[model samples]
Target: MNENSSCCTPEDSRHSGGTDVQVGEVTTTYKITGMTCGHCEGAVSSEIGEISGVSSVQAVASTGLVTVVSKAPLDEEAVRAAVDEAGYELVGQGV
Candidate 1:
């Protein structure tokens, strides 16, 4: 692929009925359950960071939020799997 080529086509850029926006980078927030401390946050962030294309991950246990910034929109199932691997439950995208 050329440098100008995007991993996702225009149609693939939008997820869950256009809720996710991809412009150079995509930032998606996922709600999680069972995160009650800093250790939980670190585990979740580390797991999600291992996913391909993920640039950064910030997990806040206080709010049970895991914000992932990536080069492209990520597959929800993959995210859920990461959370599961971190010993947490992915409650889907945040509202």
Candidate 2:
């Protein structure tokens, strides 16, 4: 499988620097609205995952929340744009 597919499996604490690097896993939860079904979840997840530095995304329609877990240096604009592109509005971001 490719590198991206490999990442989809799980989150591992392997450092390419060949050292024990403690990467800060910042999980930002975004409150979104207008998500009505599973397709909406897929769209939001895909859009956010395309942004650089965004390691993974797990979006839930019922909760109207999208949890994005990534390493340091997150682009807030990119996250917002991704949500906008998915035809949803980001109410707020925290955590």
Candidate 3:
């Protein structure tokens, strides 16, 4: 998360082994509130994409589910902030 860190790229920052990396194709699902339509989904997706570690984000408005794929591990605070910045609340998280 350092400003000058060259590890900003998805490939560079990803955790390769051990407890630091959860193992497998790790992904987290977050329940987002206030996403009533595709526009809301787009807003959420855009915000999540700005996070350095995130590889991809898919927001489903019907389910209000945000699935984030990060080449590197992601922090809980980063997830929360992305959702919050998109004008949504993260109601839950699952590994």
Q: Clash totals for all models, in order?
A: 0, 0, 1
Local accuracy of candidate 3 as per-residue lDDT tens digits, 1-95: 21211221132122222324335545778888777666676777878878886766777767988887777768878888877876788887843
Q: In angstroms, how far off is 86's CA in candidate 2?
A: 1.1
Candidate 1 lDDT by residue in tens digits, 1-95: 11212222121111122335457998888999887766666677777888999877777767988788899999999999888887788899984
Global lDDT scores for all candidate models: 0.72, 0.66, 0.67
Better of 1 and 2 by TM-score: 1
Q: Compared with the true structure, what per-residue lDDT tens digits does model 2 show for residues 1-95? A: 11111112322211111223347877778888876656667777777887777677777767988877677656777888878876787788844
Question: If ranked by TM-score, best first, what sequence of candidates would result?
Answer: 1, 2, 3
* TM-score, prediction 1: 0.75
Strongest candidate by lDDT: 1
Models, CA RMSD each: 14.0, 9.5, 10.9
Specify the poorest-scoring 10-residue window by lDDT in model 2. 1-10
Q: After superposition, how far is residue 30 of candidate 1 from its true place, in Å?
A: 0.3
